[model samples]
Target chain A: MVKKTSQRISVASLDDLVNVAGASQEQEQQYRYHICICVAAGCISQNSDAVRDALIAEVEARGLEDEVQVKGVGCMGLCAAGPLVRVDPDGIVYQSVTVDDVPAILDSLENGPVEKLILPQDIPFFERQQKIVLENCGIIDPEAITEYIAAGGYLALHKALTEMTPSEVIDVVTRSGLRGRGGGGYPAGLKWVTVAKAESETKYVICNADEGDPGAFMDRSVLESDPHRVIEGMAIAGYAVGANKGYIYVRAEYPLAVERLELAIKQARWAGILGNGVFSTTFDFAIEVRLGAGAFVCGEETALIASIEGRRGVPRPRPPYPADYGLWGQPTLINNVETFANVAPIIRNGSDWFAEIGTEKSKGTKVFALAGQIVNTGLIEVPMGITLREIVFDIGGGLPDGRNYKAVQTGGPSGGCVPEQFLDMPVDYESLREVGSFMGSGGMIVMDDSSSMVEVARYFMEFSMTESCGKCIPCRTGTRQMYDLLSKVVAGEASQSELNLLVELGDLLQNTCLCGLGKAAPNPVVSTMQYFEDEYLERLVDDNGSADEPAGES
Target chain B: MPAQATAETSAADKRWKLVEATMRRNGYRPDALIETLHTVQGVFGYIDREALKFVAERLPVSPSQIFGVVTFYHYFQMKPQGRHTCSVCTGTACHIKGSKALLDDIEAHYDLKDGQTTPDDKVSLLTVRCIGACGLAPAAVFDGEVEGSVTPDLLHERLDNWLAEEDEGNGEEN
Candidate 1:
């Protein structure tokens, strides 16, 4: 059983932090086995909590409580095969486990591996990938601060606070080739340096956990699995930028993530890690979570800041970015959850180690939430410059039902479609952008041949149209016009000139729109036209007194 | 005039106390408007005209500003929900997995469109953008429990079971 943490334990020095980790580890040594079950939202939806209960009951009935510790951990990544049960030291995973299989799992813990229930660890889904941000995930109980500390959490904060100066901390980060993981691919250290250099009395750090993409759950999973990592990362960022306050603008849709974050923030505060006088140093920092009401446009930085300030979430012009003036007119530094999650590890290890991982520019691994069509439709983190074919075929296990892969839609509505020709191409920020798709938070939705290319383009256009905040007329009206044109083409009514008009509208939106949402609104349509113009041509009306071409093979 | 619980206000209403507690926890500021509205919707299932006026009185924001903030975000619901809600996920994964067809089937069976409730107020059908539950494609949330890999038959059965249970209770709980 996980020990109930004391109400308040103030840490006056780095040695106190070390002792907490040491004590937790020493207490854990008594148990012979650690039975970890994935209790992330995806697994919880499948009743993993019930499985955990059943396993605990079985352990109690068999008098194995002393030998085995049943604990609820974070997402195991292979959410497709959840509620997953993992046995530590043995390195075995049980997939799709239920209450019925709990007794068998207990028996196998005493005996050997369960034949049918085992999730093979040798598969490319688990292998051929890296885990940096998710190192503590599925291993540590997110609610238990002791487990986190035992796993070497807060050491980075300790190092930053006690040893390194703020400038030195920024220097290490600047040398680390870490780019913003929220799809912008901006250098994170550069952002920190700007905020640090900005003349301000109060600089703030905000972790943009408002993952507004329809299918993306990487950040949600991270927040749910290891909220402390994000917390620690944010606290480090606050220390580096000479800021004492941070805010995580997460969506209200993720109730579980919010709940976990609140609990983790409380534990960190009670343990004297987050609140005033952290690690006995004069450096004091705190974090507050601002819930984002359901508005897709709020994913934009300006709109996100506006929403946090209790107003309509509308994006403003960027000459004076959030670095100069953000979050109540303070010089604010904003990075996504994934970008911050990389900070603790990059600081713990040297920046040169991180710089060696990915391609020259885009360093470190990316957490991609693979959804739709793929067999392994959950979360996966792969090193940068990995091939799309390796991801779709080897890691993703290809499309289910032996279906032919058509194209994969990356980056959500703001991103474009990637056809089969780019399958062999390396997947990095630059390569994805060159292929007409930019990583908008890494939600890869694979498409089979059954999905219509024209309809797919229309679907994204409709999403963009509905989500536009209507602040700028070019975005507000242009998206509606593009959506209308796509709809007409889908309905098989649009003439050749209307098709040309659709192309014109795509160009117009890309150039004149105010925010990132509007500028990249026509990406799906423009990209589909680039790769699959035949699909659109088939949808067009014939001028030779002939009826509309029988659309497609569908 | 200060926004307070007047003589006509429901003093005995315990739900109002929960809303008040959230507002007080947030320090009665204008920024607390969204958080306050969330608590109202959480406790009462939806925000109403009275609640909006009540929140505006406590927080340092005008009623129009509160209304605009509420209306700007889709999470806030102005109208009262039905007895039960069945939320369908129309996300990319769920959509590709034929969630639309499942939604179409539910609409046809209930003779109601998306965001509509049955005339009897038995159940409400709404399409959620995405709950980030793509692992469980073709997902739906009945009440609050998320059921993944949901088919039309499975969805209908759950909704039918809820209706039947309520009918058996005969408004005893209501």
Candidate 2:
């Protein structure tokens, strides 16, 4: 098949952008069918790229290259059964496709659906999800600017810049009830307003894509699938907050995400969407990608800013948050990738449309990376207030092989494990905090009865201890001490006094740590102790036990 | 501190030119320290003391500060990697999926712990927090290829095959 270049359009005004969108749509209508193969990291690792190559070659051999648009797209959500291929019009999704299966996929495009290969699209994994952030994820070719334009990608930025004033954009975001998706549930609009109101003439908008949560990949998915969406969101944010420069501090581990962002930025710049005078408005916005060199603490705004400044990612006191003084001491607006992603949609759909979805406090949907023992382990964007049961059992397809659900871990090292009793609990920011966990970058690792709660606590403690930046006494020394005590408990050698000491350390860390990392470090241990006190008691060494026989003795 | 050290990182090396290009793009400022080091490591596979001292001089950063930043980030490695590298995912999902057993099995089988290379300079093993592919639990990257649903036996089998190719290549060289 002929290698295609991303269609670029130079738009000087809103009408020009609309015409570009129309022309892109008209071009897309030429193809009788569209074949989008999952090319996100998850599916790519499953050799979907090679399958795409094979399908494209086959398309060439069949002389149907013009009729069929065989392109690589982003994550299809069901990652476990990738490489997933979706044929348009019929919306038939084929999972676990191989190079050898390429011929059959093409044959089915002409013929009917391959009955055995079809992954039923009506399942809760697809049907239950309400896609706001991920609306154009698997649908649009992330590399193609025309595809994004056709999908109504940058119209929100166009609308925000041309129609509304800076404060009006901020007002819409404020009324939408959207909060930061970067673990901290700070209001996104409030942050925009503060930066907009700040006295500094030189303001910066930083997209915090340094998603360090171990099990989280929401940012990665959004970046990999629809990178221009993030670029558009940042542009809108820059317009609202009176910032002309933007930087995305994404993690280096996600090489694919970095590459996609770089490519998308180039495409945006080439199309006159990123560089100076975007959409012919006097507003000048430029975005550059800065790679995070594998530090989890950099997810913190202060630490992230420090990292971007080419220093060690160490968190300092936050009285002067990033909103006030950030990125070389400028009034900066930093929003999580998912938070920024919500901006364009909120603008297009209107605040009331966004506010009407989900719970009272947490409006809009959340994208979760469901992993661990869950059957449908991939990515899901569900409305807020959706219960953990619906997420784990219905959307996730529950624990595999009929295992009993023990706990579902949210928020990586900083969050807690929710027991079976709270499976029905609505997964919003406030509700998760009530269960001693917070809506951290949306990574839910569902565990079955086979998992030990104490061991899980020890695991998170070890993560915290190892990842500690050693800048603060409370976090550096405290995480180490807590990790040691938890290790002893896991080894069945900890006494009741040691467990009590661990609780005390948790309180001390929460109260005195320098940053959120240290403050929330003890959450997993503390939450486990709260709900599974018996497990700790059972593991505690008996006072009257013989010297040779420890608590682990039968 | 030495002019001779600057002489060693001469502009003729071409590798230093790439490093110079990165610094030049950042206007040779102190803030280019991390990006400079990233380019160094990306080109050389690992950053060394030589690269560090040279970068410290080229950019407006101090040696102590460059060293501090380099060591702070886990992605920067001081030593050269072996011919092949295996990175096991120790993310929450992988840990729950018996990645610990896989790790232990690897240690026992290779007689090397995390961040260690085989004495023959054939393989290096390390652990990463996450590669953000938790859907494939107990995943590991063999060289640049990521394989999922890895068990102790499965990894060992893969290693045997991967190393067997190395052995065949060596035999041909002899």
True contacts kept of each: 0.75, 0.79
Candidate 1, A447-552: lDDT as tens digits: 9999988888888888888889999998999999988988888888876778889999899999999999999989999899999988888878854425776433
Indicate the docking level reached by candidate 1.
medium
> For model 2, what is the C-alpha lDDT against the true structure?
0.88
Scored by DockQ, the top model is 2
- Which DockQ-derived CAPRI band holds candidate 2? high
Candidate 2 recovers what fraction of true contacts?
0.79
Candidate 1 segments whose C-alpha is farther than 4 A from its true place: A6-8, A543-546, A549-554, B1-3, B167-174
Candidate 1 Cα lDDT to native: 0.88
Per-residue C-alpha lDDT of model 1 across residues B1-174, encoded as one tens digit per residue: 244777345488998888888788878877777888888999999988899888877888999988888888988898878889998988788888898899889778768678888776778888888899988897888888888899888988987876675454665855
The CA lDDT at B86 in model 1 is: 91
Clashing pairs in 1: none
Model 2 interface RMSD, one decimal:
0.7
